[model samples]
Target: MTRRSATLAVAGALIVALVAVASFFNLPYVVYSPGPVEDTLGEWNGQQVIRVDGADTFPTEGVLDLTTVGVTSADAELDLLTALRAWLDPDRAVVPRELVYPEGTTAEQSRQQNAAMLANSQQNAEVAALRKLGYDVPEKVVVDAVVEGAPADGVLEPGDVVVSVDGTPVAAPEDVVDAVTAHEPGETVQFVVDRDGEQLTEDITTIAADDDGRALVGFQPTPGFDLPVDIQIGIDDRIGGPSAGMIFAVAIYDTLTPGALLDGKHIAGTGEITADGEVGPIGGIQQKIAAANHDGAELFLAPASNCDEAVEGNNGDMRVVPVETLDDAVTTIESFVAGDTEDLASCPAS
Candidate 1:
């Protein structure tokens, strides 16, 4: 072989080795891509997504789709090549791994936390929908967890139904917090709880929070509501997160009331909703937008705080409207159906 040909072969061999090494080098980063988008008004896994029993349900048209972003598992290792590919792809993103998996958090722990958040989101969505339809949702504060080595560690166990605090009837978790903070750090607070059909009274001392001087009982309280009707959502077990709460609430409210909310127009949305109908921002708005557009969504509902990112991610074909509450979303739907889109709020231009 010629001398130049031999040197060229050796350089090509070195390039191949470098590429092979780069593909195997792991990085502390994860990729975000378009995930599955479910139509809450339709069926999933051959089952109705939303079932409303003991209450009147109206016929829903079109789709009230909830969009999700595909994320890597907490413990999944990503190589340099994978990260670079995602970064170069317009529909994908490369973000720090710690954003999804916190420090010292295991993959199993992340799954459990996501599952718990999904459960809470379902409950809050139902409550918001019921309240939107002018139904009262009475709540009771229950002991969710007791901090270890805290003042209420032994006295207040998880699953205890709180009846009253210091002779005052408490209906919500905020009421209990208010009562606890009403007293000084070392003051004793009496709690009446119902455990397994047995009513018991216990007095626990409070401790001062390090950052704030407010008194704390060192126990987490979860609100248990007395829902007027049963609303079951058949979401796949594989999907978990609080981002779907707003879409769920809209679907539930539409199911219970008369007329269709979507009006045969395809719409997609994502937001974390509160019991009182407040909408909150979520991560991976760009990937979700790409998924919705790919699925041919005509319109999208974006949380007000996520407007900038949502706008930047838009493909210019689908219209993205910003919503601050569930009511705002309903109004946007109504206006869109009526063809009065001039006054509808949208994200600023990129």
Candidate 2:
């Protein structure tokens, strides 16, 4: 070959080698970093997510809304991104974000950081609201226990209100969770509680950590409350988020009352119910319909606003009864449980 041709060939070979190296190394120029791949989306605080109570809103008491709400944080987002990257390419080296970490971080660290951030957000909201109302809302001691996994594992037990831990008084829910997590498993911890409005003391042994060496308490503290009306309302004051809680409360109330709203039939629904009896829309209407169908729910109830999504997503396989008000949800559920309408077509889809 000519000298000129030989020089061009060598240059081409060098270029190809560089490209290959970049791609294999996952160099920024060769393979662009993909944007956020969300495994789970956070809930919106001050926003209501609603669901209908049952198949037909007639017989069922009404819509059930979720009252617990959460706010988003930038740190939480970064933490999620870091987790996703670690999961996608564990062995690969990752450039640090805002934090200066010359050494690589473990998945556990990322998770803890995210949890602390979220807990802080929740604590801040609680504190600000409580202080505004001139009431003292004590921090709750949080324990995470697995059922059948440990002695402390179970839903927040009755009459368990955390007053202090290890002689250190906690003022925020996050503080309690942080303090409890400070100890390793198998350590005995002292907890001061206000049980049934009475001051009490208890010593509970922490359980062994699960697969992860992280200590497990086997139970979480459900925050106890001693507060004025404003503080009480503030805790429950998530905007548009109380629909499900309202519905559940109403259903329980209805069931406990002289007449029955369930009518002995399995009914399921989603919607937000206001304290004043207003019904609101909720997300995942289609997914919820699928869940109800899978569970053999006789009728599915959804908000009137979410009716379109439900109908479009279900493809006419399920009965989606839509309602505008909590009263409407109740009336519809009542009608269904009474066995008046057997045809699903009769109920309005949207």
Candidate 3:
């Protein structure tokens, strides 16, 4: 072969190697895709998603699914080929890695943030649901149960609201525990409680716990609001983030009240709920909407602030309704069930 032919062949080989490297190299971006859609009104592993004790739960009909989005984890590597595929797919999205995992964020830090958001979301969901039903759930550290033949049996009652322990202000159940554990076994701890609007002071002798050897007050302290009923929100622990807050509140309300909230119609939604029943926008709304659409939801509840993006991408197979609060969600569901969907708040088309 001539020298020119040999040079051209070598250049071609180098180009091929570069292309191969580009296809296999990790990219500084993440892909967003549809994830699992869970029915809030249904059960997971034979356990109800929303468990209610000390309250009557009626038989609920139809579906209330909470949507999720699948995204590349902070620790996961994304190649150029994968990013190209995602960019080509209309249902999926490719975003900068910093937009998702953020700069200087570790995988463990991302997981911890998600876990914290999930916990706060659940607490807010419980409070919003109960308060929407006209039940006042005050924020306080209340005695839930007193152990029989234990240190607090005679001194503390189930309905007593713990004000303070040993003169320290009690903001949460942990506060009471810290105060009690500060004392050694067999030590008396002073507690001030409000019983039926009447304040009273009592002293309870601490006992050593068999499991951890920690001092025990013999009463179960609930850190959240003084809920009248025992409300347990159970879902897949693998699910993280606050996007399911509105759906959870709606499902809990449906379980505690009479008549079906969905009326046999399937629905899905995503939002971050506050203690005041306000719904906030969440990330990956487009991906969540796609998941809901793929799961055959007849209606979708969207945070009012997310209307633009939700309408732009999600399949119009399901009606996307904008809701600003839990009250708006309830109203939207009721209207959808009543066949009065004409006047409901809707997202403008993109």
- At residue 51, candidate 3 shows an lDDT of 93
Query: What are the lDDT scores of the predictions, listed in order?
Result: 0.90, 0.47, 0.89
Q: Using alpha carbons, what is the TM-score of model 3?
A: 0.74
How are the candidates ranked when ordered by lDDT, highest leading? Answer: 1, 3, 2
- The collision pairs in model 1 are none
Return the top candidate by lDDT: 1
**lDDT, model 2, position 198:** 76
For model 1 the local lDDT of residue 189 reads 97
lDDT of 2 at 155: 32
TM-score winner between candidates 1 and 3: 1
Cα lDDT for residue 263, candidate 1: 86
RMSD of 1: 2.8
lDDT of 2: 0.47
Per-candidate count of clashing residue pairs (backbone under 3 Å): 0, 41, 0
Question: What's the TM-score of each model vs. the native?
Answer: 0.89, 0.34, 0.74
